[model samples]
Target: MVTKESWSMSIWPMAPWKITFLIYQREKLLWIGIQMKVAAGAAKGLEYLHETADPPVIYRDFKASNILLDAEFNPKLSDFGLAKLVQLGIKTHVSTRVMGTYGYCAPEYALTGQLTSKSDVYSFGVVFLEIITGRRVIDNSRPTEEQNLVTWASPLLKDRKKFDLLADPLLEGNYPQKGLHQALAVAAMCLQEEAATRPLMSDVVTALEYLATNKDAGQGGILEEPEEGEEDHIEADS
Candidate 1:
């Protein structure tokens, strides 16, 4: 029986393989719907924060660690202590002291106290890298030059064929490959060096929704469809 305790491995971040294993339990048709909805919900929440809120708050520090998933695996953006509101006519929010997690901090914000909505986009980009690569923002264990997940994975993102690199090793090819790549593309754009280059969160949501709908329709997608027995395979739900 799937009890609250038993659902931890399936829902929590511990051992990404649990999620992969869940993906392996159901047919492509079943799990693909669930995955798209979960991811799209996350995209929509981000969009609401950027556009629906009164002043449009900036999620200064956005990372997977901050993203919490429920039993259904729906993604939710959390931790707003670092969140900032962008006031109209205010060119920038300046701080005498800069604050944020090291790896997720935007290069410009880290160097200067300037804060903008774009800074959050950069962090979101890093989160995307994490979700795709199944690697942390910073991994010191890797070789000298490959410590930063973005630095190591950006090139592979550029190469469409090499998208497989983004899959978590623990998954063993369980995720929808194309969907992962498409999500990576969204992340890559968010990580772009120039703040202006990054798409607005609203746009990001639309893109994700469109991608999800298209994937649902089987009309070719940025993400891929699930293989056989992907979802029902979750460790018998404990």
Candidate 2:
């Protein structure tokens, strides 16, 4: 007979999951600059996992819900149950069981069992799209053409003229258009069908870092800072 023991741990005491749908639904929580910050933070976290770990770890499941936000809105990654450690060897990719959220998994990983850091990159691209568009990865309630976010948005991402159509309406056209283009370009590269073509997490981190730093660049000549006493923790969607 085999014996098993289970332990429960509270990963997030007061912080909440950083689901873009919930964050954008709130009136004052969605800001272009803030979104950039969140993206950069998440990228840095993934970069650390891919590059700093003793034997690099592949975050098999990377999505908006897996990202958590503290009271200050700082992002942190959670749910390491599905994480896999890469062995120190000459192997280029790890072969494993296919597992992850439906709309966020990489096509190759979903079809085959091959897992790589790039799989996480693809999932990050989906979440990055969600943050930009303020939409869910898969929303059946939406119109037929708009039901699947990536399917509808991917074609439009390449054309700068159509970039505005993909932005979150809640932004009210207040974001820097140039920044939007740059961010979308990063997302597009990450979403590449070929896993080998996708940039490394370190590269992704650099791109997002630039976006976060220059968020105010094209903001129609008006850049306003948050008020001193404003609430930091916005209400989550029901």
For each candidate, what is the lDDT?
0.65, 0.75
Stretches > 4 Å off in candidate 1:
1-38, 174-177, 216-238
Please tell me which predicted candidate would have the highest TM-score against the true structure: 2
lDDT of candidate model 2 versus the reference: 0.75
Please give, for residues 1-238, the per-residue lDDT of candidate 1 as tens digits.
2357533122334423223333333334433435445556656766777778777777877765666556666666766778887887674788788988988888778888787877877886776566555577787988977798888887887887787777755456655555566667788888887777988877777766775676332223333435456444322100
What TM-score would every model get versus the actual structure? 0.71, 0.82
Q: Candidate 1 — worst ten consecutive residues by lDDT sum? A: 8-17
lDDT for 199 in candidate 1 is 87
Query: Taking the tens digit of each residue's C-alpha lDDT, what string does model 2 give over 57-109?
Result: 89888988888888667888898899888888743564666788899999888
